[model samples]
Target chain A: RMDQGEKKLSSVDRTPLHTEYVKSKLNLEGKDEVRKLKLFMKYIGVYGADARISGFSGYICELLIINMGDFHRTIEAFAAMRGKLVIGDPENTESFDSPAIVIDPTDKTRNAAAAISVENLSRMKLCSRLYLNGKMPEYVQSNGQRKDAKDRGTNLRVFRIKKPDIMDDILYPQVMRFKNAIWEIMERNDLRPVSWEVCVKDHIDVIIESENKAVPALKIHQGPPVDEPSSLDFYNKWINMKISRGPYILGDRIYVDLIRQQKSIGDVVREGLKKVNIGKNIDDQKEAMEIFDPYDTGKDSCALDLFLSKFIFRAHPPEKTSRNTRSS
Target chain B: RMDQGEKKLSSVDRTPLHTEYVKSKLNLEGKDEVRKLKLFMKYIGVYGADARISGFSGYICELLIINMGDFHRTIEAFAAMRGKLVIGDPENTESFDSPAIVIDPTDKTRNAAAAISVENLSRMKLCSRLYLNGKMPEYVQSNGQRKDAKDRGTNLRVFRIKKPDIMDDILYPQVMRFKNAIWEIMERNDLRPVSWEVCVKDHIDVIIESENKAVPALKIHQGPPVDEPSSLDFYNKWINMKISRGPYILGDRIYVDLIRQQKSIGDVVREGLKKVNIGKNIDDQKEAMEIFDPYDTGKDSCALDLFLSKFIFRAHPPEKTSRNTRSS
Candidate 1:
């Protein structure tokens, strides 16, 4: 049933023969240690193979527990790890490249931690270190209370697009691609998006906090090098054209100050969306996209939680003011 | 008379002993070929050893005329040359490094074209090519007429400073250094300077035309990478600080949007002058510096001439409208 394409696997597929194969391969004969560790991984939000989670699946947790011997050792291993981390047979490990790599015990060709993203892997290391250092509560315990978005006084642009009827596997990646497209557009226009987050549920919500909402009226436009044949073309094009300053040489190149066509960030994004390759499903529904200020829009609790937990709160370790006070 | 540093050289310094030595070494047996070439070089503004000129000295022209056999051949050689051009004995040419090199016939230790700048060398090449191609009159002839400063409609900033009682060699370099310092200041404050010129006679005039007279209010400030130990310090510093947008993550690094202190080009230049090394003499009289719009200031004919001859007109070859018409 599992081998048949589009056929949903039921309890009939889970035979004693398959269970025995998994038990023998992972060396999990009588112990419930891996099961308890999987529960803890689930609690910490690093327990899914889905695109949205990009974390440890149940099988990966089982493999890690068996490889490391216990939960404490696994946490310690992750906390100590830096850069790329690879586990399993040397030959199998060489084949996989990611922030965290765990080769499958049963299948040497498959990477067990393939779903884990660099950001999620980084988060795991951070959280492990925090738990070990006795500062886990500040991060792990989500109280669901955060400072008002307006109180932060940040230049937040919240974009809401109607969610396309697609599977979670397909939809989340498209949402991320669309978010990155918007980021590229913002960067190209010099809007300077500092931080951004994407939350997908009933509607796809993208929150981008930028340096400025508008670009300056005049922008420097660099031309070809003076020695190049095309420099004459550049000179002729801008000489009669309306410019703020140049048609002037700086070093070996020519430059001009042309009046910027699109000044506002909103206009840049709206105009740029048509040019960039935003995932096809999202692109089809881009016409109905609504841009709003953080305060103006009806706030999504999930988006606010993600902004706080993933970005704002997790950006730094708790300040050592208490330690300073004790020492004083 | 020439041996005494304070005493100016006269005809007494030009004794038969020195004349015989020059004529013998340069192979000038009563021929006026080098003299005629020197006069032509002077006409095209490439015949001076002063810092203001930075062109071929009279002696360098004579050496070149002897080395290349005539003025036409010398111009042809310069037109054909690319990158660094070295003339004279292969042994002596290795010691001197410049855009154009001519080893002294009498003194192999000294470079004859040492004062010739990269710009002057480029001008020589351009003028030579134009002269050869029969486009000499367009560049070489000075009719003492140009468009009015107001008619061009460029953002021209003219600054006049009282000239210190100093030699031409000392004053010109200092004036150039001051102009470069102002250019650096403008660039640092995000005011894009396109072209600049300095004219020092009774008064030192520095003109810089820029992309804008002011910078934007908000500017992006990059911080430490997230993995680095200083990132926490960066986060703490900007968390409560008055900023426009961030203290947020981009890739592995952190960034913020801070308010720009100095906006106007004048304020940036004035404040920056105190910090930079704009030559000692100019720095002493920086307080007396007067910045003005091109329309507001009384236009100097010499400055206007230079603006037209070197930068404005010489920036590009004349439009090929006639060529297109003939071809059509």
Candidate 2:
């Protein structure tokens, strides 16, 4: 009944038989991991989380637990393996592009681990290594420490967004696109942030941390090479540039350092956001959006929590305020 | 007293005496046409209409009239020149890269036309050719008959910016930067405009005309090629892509038809503006910024006027709307 394509066809036809046979074989060897493997897979991720997410499947999780024993050893094996993780020696290895590849224990010809995502794999590795060392990193939406980004000398910009009415599979790409849009905006304005991350729950929170709350007054500009036809247009544009200094020639390229009017990161983001496609769902509730910083914005604890747990560690950065080193 | 470098040193040491001699010589030839030349230069631009604009200076303009004989003929000569216009050749042409090069009439060694900008040359050729052919374009800001842009089935977005309290020398570049920033925004949003123009006046108006008012529901997305390590990420991201079709492979490239959440151009701009550095002066009066279509926006004839004289010429586009034959 759950028909979509060839994958669904196989699942409907052979999945039940494979499940019964694999379980009985595991029972004979007293190697079935109903309790342990299920818990491990859940902790790492919802096995093959979405139909579109080609991460770890329950069958792969079961096979891994049987073969590698417990959670600790199974994850350790995955981490230690370099490059493509080819499991069974099948005759034809035409190759695949999934993050991790594992052969089916019951069906020698199939790849059981074809759906695992690289992002999920990266998460699993980071979490496993930390957990094994007796420390657990905060997962998304999990409450953790609350450190103000400003106190750490980092420029923090929190955008309170309304999550789109979409599932994680679709929402993941949309949110990623939104992040790219913000990142591009930040870079374009020369308020290039050192780091950024997104968190989604009841609502979406975008956290951007830059070295400076405001960029330097001067904007270093580049134009066409000395020879091109448009290089003259560049010269014309800059010679009549509306700034404090320059339209000066810097070697073969035209370079200028003009004063920027909107130097603050908050101001830039506030204004620049009106220029790009920020996804439709967020666009609908765009008016309801809230932008926050540490100094004056009526403090929200959720934003603070996200900054503390996700962005920074309690270990203080050497300096309280990062210098705008990019002012060259 | 003013000291910058070589250009200044030359201007101070030798330029004044040359200016005096040229005026006297032109007078002897019954051609002390300073008044005539000044008006012509201002009309054609490059007569210091903009502080930073390095076009034909008054001295260069005078030299041109004396050599080419009056306004009409001077423009004709400029229009006929091939690649790099070589004026009366100096003894040794070491070759400088400024737009039009002319051997200084006063000091045979110096290139008098070095200050002449390409933008001016381009304007000169365009205006001169058009004039000779019995026409004159509404250069920069001139009152001309207005025509509607929408009847042709094109997308026009207007941004009315409050002019910054800066001189033209400084203002020209800033507005250009603003235009470029908006262009990047439009492209990123997939509302890639076919043509974009900026008009600077008491208020700066940016006009962007795209073939699309709204994009298709799907976005034909591309990512890293297969066999590369990052290709796995491309696969993982799209395989579970939400609310769309495909993570299909075209040769070695990964492709997806993502359902665009924000399909409308207006919505994207409204939302995207919040994420960038919209410059200082613009940010201050950003709330006052208005975006609208033809029938809706309260009659500000200036915007409509620019769209007409500057963009459309009442000439039919033979094939109305260009369908996205690019759907290949």
Candidate 3:
């Protein structure tokens, strides 16, 4: 590496600090058990050099092994794990926001498992639990996409958004933001999604499961209080409308419950997207925004897998496995 | 009335302090301008004593007149008021909560308007605004029931509970409680009620106007988190159920989106009511839960007025001007 005289050049093929830290963390015998297990877990899903999975890194596996003292113990902790997983909170949780938090013992500033995504963490957790329960799901051992929820009587939809030409680090967060924005928009429209997941890879796919796959005809619109100057504007626009139920005061505000113009989830998204700026990738992708219905076949096979892995077979053992799921 | 010997026995028809307070507060002309306006407001709706309205006493009228310096100003204040109304906090708001707050200058410990209900306050505010705006709604000057939302393309329902055999104060609060309880329950069931009013008159009428008079079949059921011990129990209950969906992990808890048994609002309320001990008044009122569909006329004419008063014509000065007078 060359540098100007003002900025002196220095080079070391391998840093002593990082090498020492990695070596000490890998106390397991043989040719690194952490690396082997991580490789073995990779075949089942999206896990490679540039996979979208957040957690389950080789270094994180090493740290987890060191923290649990063994591979079996690490898997056992995962099997027994319910909600949160905190591994060595050196600073005692000053600010940690991730599915799993594993603070680096060697360097307090670093977090070994901080990059792990909820999808990956839950997948690993579920796999561990299933392996321990002896009813191991075949998806972990074998590979390929997830199964369809065809006969499941579910209202699930998946939108595969094309990734931008930006860097992965920059693109991942944007995808997440877009996912959350859509979730919030859907909720406001009364689609009330029960489960949702966003995966960023070759493409950014947002999958959501909701109660009302369709939309209702009516929605209540809250206006400014009756005494405000703005209330007059609100009254003038809605009061005389045949669709408006009210131009009356309730509590402090004037409200009108009227018929919805677009009463479908698809219509809402199609129209709602046009209102936001939503960056280049989403805006530029010509054939983007592919909606795969729960029963859709062929092209939706992989989406079905991601949705199932993230929602249904989520690797976490099912809690309610036997009785009636619906209310009577 | 005679008091105990330990306290004191007095024969003062009117206390000197109260008389002095009223006199000093009434800065307007001869025959008590506040009294005349208060009496006029009473004839139209629930303002009269033992009528449907709650709060707005003669003492409160006196305080309002003193605060505004005259009847016109008091009415102007109401007309211009939008949301919250707070008056004369000589001590700068030492915690007060009411629909409207009028601090009694004479007795600093009391809030003369503390007993005011949101319904009565909003009615007065709307009426005042309309009267001042010269769009004096006829309902403000007449006495009758409400109207229907049949032509409005809206969904509204009314539940008129027979008042429990109790005193005025006791029964009124209970009616309010029942109204609030039903409102919350309906909201939980996704029947978003925009306007609701409770009137305890010939019958304890609890009228409600909502967006979803009918119910949806689908409902999302939330379960314990993936790590909880009960989560396994929850799993055991629903995993094999014919009606179940994902029972998936989202964030910390397990959730399942499934179909509800009663897909109609009326059915849910009827069956839901049977499950809880919703007091005897509601329990004993046979044929009490009458379904008054706006378009269904034979049984809706009477309900229309109640629903209209409690919801629609609430503020647009009552157009119909002549009927029986309660207070003159």
Q: Per-prediction DockQ, in order?
A: 0.13, 0.02, 0.29
Which is superior by TM-score, 1 or 3? Answer: 3
- Top-down lDDT ranking: 1, 3, 2
Q: How well is candidate 1 docked (DockQ)?
A: 0.13
The DockQ value obtained for model 3 is 0.29
What ranges in model 2 sit over 4 Å off? A1-328, B1-18, B28-56, B69-73, B86-98, B102-120, B126-146, B263-267, B270-288, B301-303, B311-328
Order of candidates by TM-score, top first? Answer: 3, 1, 2
B31, model 2: CA deviation in Å? 3.9
Predicted candidate 3 versus true structure: per-residue lDDT over B1-328, tens digit per residue: 1225544422142346556888865655723778766764664343533323554777677767776777788888887886556887646334566777777665555565666767567767766766676654344421232233553345666666565667775565556666776777778887667666555545665667676656655566888756666766675577556543555655566676566554565665666665555555466662466545535544433334444543334422222311232232
Relative to the true structure, how large is the alpha-carbon lDDT of every model? 0.64, 0.55, 0.58
User: Estimated TM-score per prediction?
Assistant: 0.68, 0.42, 0.72
lDDT of 2 at A91: 52
Report residue B277 deviation for candidate 1 (angstroms).
4.1
Better of 1 and 3 by lDDT: 1
A-chain TM-score per prediction? Answer: 0.81, 0.68, 0.67
> Candidate 1 vs candidate 2: which has greater DockQ?
1
* Candidate with the larger lDDT of 2 and 3: 3
- Lowest lDDT block of 10, candidate 2 chain B: B312-321
lDDT of 1 by residue, A1-328 (tens): 0234555433235345335655775654324667766665655566677877777776677677778887888888877776666898887788677777887555566666888876566556655655676654433322233344454434678778888888888888888998999998888776767677777766788888775577645466888755554655676676556564545554445666556654677778888998876787888778778888756765442444455444333422212111122211
- What are the per-residue Cα lDDT tens digits for candidate 2 across A1-328? 1125535435657688768866765663335354565565555443554433445666776677676766668767654544455566645234545666666655655667766665455545433444555554343232232223443444677777787778776676666676777777788876656555566656676777664466544455666544454654664565443543333333334454455564577567667777776776566654566778745665543434434433101111112212221121
